[model samples]
Target: MESTSCEKNNVVDALTAVEMLAALEQYRAELSEKDRVIADLRSRLEILEGVNHELQLQLGRFHDVLKPLTVQLTHNLQLSAGRHEQYALPTGGARLKRLAISAEPVDVGLQHTPAKKVPKNDV
Candidate 1:
């Protein structure tokens, strides 16, 4: 009877050890899956950060290229505004004053004149 009891206890201990090993293997597989997910997320984040940095650089270059054009357009607009203001006034008074000071008589000319014939024998 003593020998039978010892054999039964040994069998139970062996079964418990097998269960523990199976549990350990399952835990290792879950940990590996979590690690793979973390690595993929990290890689994606790095790619996005690089793209964002490139976009910022491109935007800065665009602003630099447009800066001179914007300044030239503003200067041209100011000059045009000054010219418009000059032409907006009338020159009739100055013209009348100049005509009053002239001693020569004004003559009206014909709008269209007849064409004169050229002699072909002169060539």
Candidate 2:
């Protein structure tokens, strides 16, 4: 008769089993936490996308309303300037530049962001 060996039996040690269970529980907890964070980020992204769409709509409306005024202003400026050199002429001690400055607060309907400074010699 052939002798049977019991050493090859699949068995887990007590300490190793406990460690595996603990590791599995820890992994589950980490996964749950990651899932929650991902959900929050997705929600925030949706809100930001909505805000961006609204801003684009507002910008389109702004351009629509300002088109005529902008055309008229350009015509007047061209007439007064006569040539490119006269465009830099000072008015009331201030040069013709962007109205908003970096230090000024711009209203975005939700919060205020600092306006970017328009560099000199840039249109």
Best by lDDT: 1
Per-residue CA lDDT of model 2 for 1-123, tens digit only, reads 122333323243556778999999999999999999999999999999999999999998898788667666765778788745434544333445644466434556525554569988896
Instruction: Estimate every model's Cα lDDT from 0 to 1.
Output: 0.73, 0.72
- What's the number of clashes in each of the models? 0, 0
lDDT of 1 by residue, 1-123 (tens): 999999999999889999999999999999999999999999999999999999999998897788667655655786878743233222322221121455343444533444468899977
Worst lDDT window (10 residues) for model 1?
90-99
How much is 54 displaced in model 1, in angstroms?
Answer: 1.1
Q: Which ten contiguous residues of candidate 2 have the minimum total lDDT?
A: 1-10
Runs of candidate 1 with Cα error greater than 4 angstroms are 67-123
Report residue 63 deviation for candidate 2 (angstroms): 0.9
